[model samples]
Target: MSQLERADRILDTAQDLLLRWGYRRVTIDEIAKRAGVGKGTVYLHWRTRDELFLAVGAREAVAMIEAVAAAMRADPAEIALHAYMRRFFLEAMRRPVLRALFTRDTDTLDRFLSSPARQPLQGAKLLASREYLGALADHGLLREDLRPEDLDYSLPTIAFGFFAIEPLLPKELALGLEEKADQLADVLRRTYGPARPPSPARLAAAAPEVVEIFERLAREYGAVAYGTTKGGDPEHGS
Candidate 1:
């Protein structure tokens, strides 16, 4: 098999083991065994167990970002702040690894939570960046009164609550994932969206820019996940 294909197979095996056994219990020996490669081969791809798991986390982040970008490309209306939040929430819910990262599931992630790799994976910061929010504001999708600083704090706090709160409620009382996502979209719309909707022309004009921002994020995360660069701002390869 090609080297790239072998690396992906190893990653696939590692991610499966991580989801099934959690980080604390999964080991390199098992990952190599399952991937049909020697333990040394796994090391060749990822020098340490922590790096391997971090790559898994980064890969999941890339998938979620790409999914959100895809939705925006397919529908210009999805470029609006509220629509983006809805799509992001649903995408996170659909990926167990990504969901764990968002919810801070320590049982699954443990010490990996504190890894520097976690920084770029925080989609909240990327999504709420001045550039991203400014684009929304320019398109009249964001409320005129909202500042970029306000979003930097509010978006992550609000998204965190949604990710962290669901598991705390009783199963019988908890809302389904789709319903919760809708509620999240509603809250974001009421809190950040303009009182008057932007025209379709504005949304269409904004789609390429909004989608490009997310696509860039995906590339950064993909670099970290695939070991093209060490952890830290993937843009500079730091």
Candidate 2:
């Protein structure tokens, strides 16, 4: 197999172990064995366990970004603030590793939660950045009155609360995933969306820019996850 393909196999094994066993309990030897590679081979791809798992999270983030970007391209209305959050929330929820990363699930991530390796995962937070919010506002998809700084906090708080609170609620009282996503979308719409829907023309015009943001995020995160970026190269020096 090619070097890239072997590296991906190691990553795939690491991600599966991370999801099934959590970061604290997964080990390089086990990952190597599972991937049908020697321990040295795994180290060739990732210098340390922390770096490996961080790549796992980055990969998941790239996948989620790509999925959302694809959805936006297929339906420009998905570029609307509410629709964007809804799709993003659902995508994160559907991916267990990504869900853990989003919510900072201590049970799953343990000390890796605070490790510097967590930095690349911040790429996902770009959705809440001023540049992104400004782009949406420019298209009249976001509330005109709200500043990007205001949204930087509010957007993540509202969307993250759903993930943070779900496990705390009683199963009997808990809403189904789709129901919760719908409610979250409704709240985001009321809070951040334009007072009225943007015209179809506006949504269409916004689609390219909005989708580009996510596609850019996917490329960046993929580079880090797959060690394509300079400092991100695990094979050299992560």
In order, candidate lDDTs are 0.80, 0.80
lDDT of 1 by residue, 1-238 (tens): 6566777898999989888888899999899888887776676667678888888877887889888888888889998877888888898878888888788888888878888656655654455367788888877788988776678878878967988986587867757888988999899888898988888999999889888888888887777677642243222210
How does candidate 2 fare on TM-score? 0.90
Candidate 2 lDDT, tens digit per residue, 23-86?
8899998988998877776766666788888788788878888999999999999988788888
List where candidate 2 sits over 4 angstroms from the true fold: 121-124, 228-238
**Clashing residue pairs in candidate 1 (N, C-alpha, C atoms within 3 angstroms):** none
Model 1 global lDDT (CA atoms, 0 to 1): 0.80
Q: Which ten residues in a row have the lowest lDDT in candidate 1?
A: 229-238
TM-score of each: 0.89, 0.90
